[model samples]
Target: MTKFFLLLSAAAIAAPAHSQTSPDSDAPEVVVTATRAAQPLSEIGQAVTVIDRAEIERRQTTVLSDLLATTPGVTVTRNGTVGALTSVRIRGAEADQTLVVIDGVRVNDPSSTGGGFNFGNLLSSSVERIEVLRGPNSVPWGSQAIGGVVNIITAAPTEGVQARANAEYGYADSVFASAGVSGKSGPVSGSLTGGYLRTDGISSATSGTERDGYRQYGATGRVGVEFAPGIGLDLRGYFADSRVAIDGFPAPDYVFADTPEYSKTREAYGYAGLHANLADGRFNNRVAFTIADINRDNYDPSFGNDPSFIGRGRSERYEYQGDFRPLDQVRVVAGVEREDSRFNDGFTFADTGITSVYGQLIVKPLDVLTITGGVRNDDHDDFGSHTTFGANAALALRTGTTVRASYGEGFKAPTLYQLFSDYGNRDLDPETARNFDIGVEQAFLGNRARVGVTYFNRRTRNQIDFRDCSPSELTTPGSICANRPFGVYDNVARAEADGVEFTLALRPVDALTLTANYSYIDTENRSVGDDFGNDLARRPKQTASVNADYRFAFGLSVGGTVTVVGDSFDDVGNTTRLDGYALAGVRAELPICERFAVYGRVDNLTDTRYETIAGYGNYGRAAYGGVRLRLK
Candidate 1:
């Protein structure tokens, strides 16, 4: 109450700032990943973050994972440089527990041995915006959402004819270039983008000195047509081909040399959808179909044979959703979906299918109070049925302050490899999670400056772990043991994680902007094992970042970022240790003309050595200069 009164007094003093509010402002922009329908970020109860294309371009980051690492509640671990295997974890969840979506399609590889999305090959050249929703949100997204969701939106035509191109050169003999064209004509709008990059990257093994190279080419296209006043048809497609050098496992001594090994990856993703607005725009309906396919070929000529392994996977999904606003202050959303997944390796094939239905409601009964609730039912081909639910509330105080809380359930079904492979266990149950969060925020300077704090807790049950089993244990008819010496996946342990996240954004002057965030996570493994009572592997206890940018009157912009990552355990047994590290970077841009700009970036300013993964090597100081052209 005291804070509320203080804010009221501030509002009165700043009454002249009332003209700063707008629906198109950053704070009021519509976000869809939270509830499957567009809602202003200021009205959302869940913790969400949006990174626009302007910020992405200003950072001059080559890989998408680099942009995500600085986000609060997110941690990225890469085995090597770009094109190497990379994992992203949110809120202390495992890598596989988070889901990645591209234009409403789940893109996680079904055939991956780890059953997770590889962030190494993802590029930002064709992205318009990215939304990261933290915490359990499995109601709209079926599986692999125990942690959170990363939703990527591809670029689209905004108005008249437009074209843009970029080219850059950097360290390790790397080169990057991209071109795009977009336009709107009458009832039709479309965009096409293409990019190619190659890098002679640093070594992967900590003790190795040889370089590992990578190359990739990709294209993205989208077209949308309006059939009637409020009806539309959309089509989207993406394809990529790349080859990356591989570093084999080390010997018992945990030291090795780089070898002549590489793997080729090919991917194709497509989406088609139709949307309509009826009943004077009070009712909205949309139907979409999506497909994701991937193929991989591996070769190690140094091993005598020309090849080692080949893999294939595919997934398809069909969905329908509806949003209704029967009352002025109430809204409802409902949806149904079906998805199929398949994995193949020459002689063996595995498949799974799932069907689900979900519903959510939002109501504002009181002038200052808003409530949201949702539930979902999933029916799996092998696991029968499971139910999940979520609830949230938010209150807006008179001083432009807000308080919010939420609780949600999450579940993830076992992968095909876990259920039907040589070391599979068909009796393994789906992993379940219970998560909750509470937060408060206060606005200063008429929303120009803002501060917020959030606390979150999540507990998971029936976690799958692999352990050695004796012959007798494997011989039993009804057991959780496999015959292979590598052990089998089985429900073994439980886990709980709690964390606090803080964020601040301030525009103290018209030409300068500053932002900072910090996150602290504490994890507990409550199962009897070597890792019991220890924190999860690679989950740091503290991570913080600070960034500032300033623009001069002469069309020059300068910015820098400082990042700190605390110490963490690399192995589950808490044996291998990784020391904490801090890194700094700087960037600058100068506008040459209204439609063209020149920029330069320098990373690892102080050349601080660090390792996100225990045995992997990170690049030292690197410099890059690029040119950008835009015409509309």
Candidate 2:
């Protein structure tokens, strides 16, 4: 499989060059997360993957994480079924290091142990677009961007009134449905979407017998009003409520098994902004306020009806951004932001705040060359002040070649839970990292085919990890473990990751499209411990996927995808191994008249048995069928 990927990559690079055009004309051409401003793909030096609504529907993906797994430089692991604990890692970075933004609002949970966003309950119901940046970018986004950033854009108003609805049913007693509407009238524009899903999921424990169930309800809304030519007010909001049955360690033998245990999560975020463009769109300014609130509870029927555990997290942010273009060749973007976060564990409460200011310069010294530089300073209430810098350059040649390079620094403050929880440490320092990458891409066959390769390296220090207390330390007075008996969080680990990514896209003919990408990531723990030099837990060294889709002249479409992953150890000590596996999926859509269509998909077509995490059961072969309706 590795050899096949390499050979395909070589063939693509060796292909003859032709007049340059976009390899995928239908893909989103503008990206907003790279510089906190909309920029053409050719001008951005970062490694990014853009997935639009058309691509999502083509694959018939119901879950957002399932779609993200197909992108390059990304890896996803779900503990068991659909609604279990899910984590996404980029370029071998920790799951919590990735920053998640929805409609321009940060949604990381401050009350969680790692303060990361759970992708398990995220559905593709109202998502219009998704942008994944595969390297550290702290200059514009602030903390928790050590790994990279995932920016999600939900449904928005269009030029005319439109309505869409979809419904599906499948194995495991599952049901899914969603509906959305968007329109513009005069100066006002608005959109709203609602989604629901429920399923009798597979057991979380490998040895369990009972079936676990899951359910979710979600909605997204956006409204905008233009008062003047370039002045507008924007409001956006999102909410999701979910409940999932989970397995737990039983009391008798203390072994993993099915139990009457469940978890519930409620998440909501909102954003409001006022913007104006002056000097004929040369100078733009925006003032925004954003808030995110999340609540989680765990219950055990044997222990009564009340929740056994409860957690609440909330964040409020105020920010101002300005963009100025004095000349066509130079542009400047600057922003100031203040964010406050609070967390409660039903028994204890804590709060923290951070203030930051940043500025970036984008200059086009030549028509084909673009360079960008930026710096940021953040003042945390507990961790003092820290600074970060980043730079990147992109060069495009008339010979159908483009070269890109970037260097970025990342700084992440400790989460509220890590600083105030029972096992927390107040003297912990912030985690930091340095990331670099370079790549070259070539267009061939009149840009109907393209090939690209990139190399990236990152080093992280002062990584926070839990350290168990020794017997002597527990007995010593005034020690770090004076009160805590089990363990404490401390900055004790260092790590490094280096990887290569290859991408190929081909449009051999007008009706068929094929795309493939392969990633090889090497990660190691460099901390001073017995586990030093060992590969990071659950991080496979190689992952690759190939997808093809064809649209017939008879209003019918068919697509299929195959994904392969390499083996890796499941523990930092390299004791247990989790063998890798391959998965295949097939989907077809046929239009019935002009406003309705029918779709069906078969996942795990070969019934391959695999597990991303140890001792967790994965899905088997399943089939689903759905229908879609559109009105304009």
Candidate 3:
């Protein structure tokens, strides 16, 4: 699969030549939020990708997971169909290492034992653009940013009153509806959005008929005021409610028992900030206070005796951040954050809390040189305090070419469940890592053709693992009796992972675009006194993807994408290996009028059967179509 994608990418680059074109001829300018300042894609120094509203409509993507799955260096995993526990990983890092921000506010749950983002609750329609940074971003973002960052920027109000509506239906009896309104009057501007989505998911087994699935409804609103040329304040909030069904264990005939599992989630986030201009236009300052609350309730009927388990988790976070540019060549940003979290299984688990402080600095000595450094200190009540640091330097060699090198340290504090779980047996320490990366980027033909490659290495120490052991009378003052002793978490392993990635984008013609990416990883764990010391899990050896789009003269556009995933192991034993697979998708867009459009998309064009996660079923072939309206 990897070789196939490489060939495809090579073919795209070697195809028929065309005259060079100006940057303006490629596409319209897109604003990004990852840098905290709106800038065109060509000016941003980071490895960023922006998915604009037009692309979103053309692809007919209705969910955050759906959109991210198509991007390079990203993969999505879920425990079950709709509304299930879902997470995204970048490169080959753990899901928890990636940071997710919605409207400039971090939304990762502090109560989760694994520190992963909850993608199941994030809606897609309210988003105007998404900015993705594909490498360590600790210098700009704080903790849990070892892997990368994903920022979801919502739509802003228009100049005058405007309204729009959208609806869609697709395979598996799926239905969706959304509406939004935006307006500005005097010094005030605001936008309000609401939507609902439901789907009877695909069967958990090949021949199974039961359709245990999910339904969700959500609303969001944002308002802002401008007092002066460079001063403003904005506030935003969001709420959602959802219910999903769980898939039971597979039966002898690959059938799954049908059962309804209930899960309700609610999130409210808001921020008030001031943006000011000083020293003419070269100096700027921004300060903001943000608050977020997340609550979740889960009821499952397939665990333990009487087959029932009820749980609730709540988390709240407060943040104060400020960034300043004292001069045109220097930018500094720093922030302090605190998180309070509580969890209950109706009984048995204690509440936990974590707090952290961090700061960063970015300096440019010359027009072609940039340096950045930052550090974070986390003071956890249970595991004490730990500090992490990161630094990077980049140099522009010549026109359309740059090289960068970076080093960073990361740490993950022990969760309450790991330290004080009901069945836990011992204490645990934090996990830590030191990472290094070097890369080069180039854009030729007046920025119409781009290529980038990066190499990364990470060494982890004190890695956590669960251990189970039985005690004898000599050690435990008990008779030599058999017992299924539960496991406990411990920091007892060391490991290293290294990888390389390559990306290319070319627009040889005014109406055609081609993009491709590839990644290869090698990982190993070195731990003595363990049965599977050298095992590698959750890491694929190689992966690749390619995309192409062409626009016709009659206001019609067609695009196709292909992704190939390589073999990976699920556990240390290496006995459970998932086979490699390739999947393809195609999309079409037709403009009905200047302000209206219709789009259709077909995923898994070959009806391929593959699993991104072991023991979890994935969707096969599916088709969807929708209509989009613009009030601009």
Model 2 is weakest, by summed lDDT over 10 consecutive residues, at 13-22
Cα error of candidate 2 at position 225, Å: 0.7
Backbone clash tally for model 2? 0
Tens-digit lDDT track of model 3 for 1-632:
65465545543443321111122254634544334554444334445566766666655667787667656667676665666778887766678777888877777765466656788767686887787776666544555665678888777888989887788889888888888999999889999999899999755433345675778888878898989876788787777777776665444654455544456666676666676666665556666666556666666654423425444455556665556777777776666767666555545566666677777677788877877778878777677777878777777766978787878776666655556565432356777778788888887887788788988887777777666645652256432222425545667667777888887777767787777778887777666665435546766777777776777889887777767778887777677887777877777778899878888888877777876667667778899888877775
For model 2, state the Cα shift of residue 533 in Å.
Answer: 0.5
Query: Against the hidden true structure, what lDDT does model 3 obtain?
Result: 0.69
C-alpha RMSD in Å of predicted model 3 compared with the true structure: 4.5
- Model 1, range 1-632, lDDT digits (tens) per residue? 23223332332332211111111244456789888899766567888888887778877777888878888899999988678888999999988898899888899888876578888888877888889989989987878888899998988877999999999999998999888999999999999989888999988888777788889999999999999988999999988898899777545564455867888899889999999999987899999999999888888886667558877889999999999999978999999999999998655689999999999998989868878899999999987899999988888787969898999888888888778877777887888899999999887786678788999999999887776888887677766663566688888878899999998777766676767788998988877867789888899988876666667899888777767788899978788888888777778889999999999988877677889998799988999999999988
State how far residue 291 of model 3 sits from its true place (Å). Answer: 3.9
- Tens digit per residue, CA lDDT, model 2, 251-350: 9888888898999999999999999999998999999999999999999999899999998999999999999999999999999999999999987799
In candidate 3, which residue pairs get closer than 3 Å at backbone N, Cα or C atoms, i.e. clash?
A: none
Candidates by TM-score, descending order: 2, 1, 3
Stronger candidate by TM-score (1 vs 3): 1
Any residue pairs clashing in model 2, and if so which? none
Tell me model 1's lDDT, rounded to 2 decimals: 0.83
TM-score of each candidate structure, all chains considered together: 0.94, 0.96, 0.87
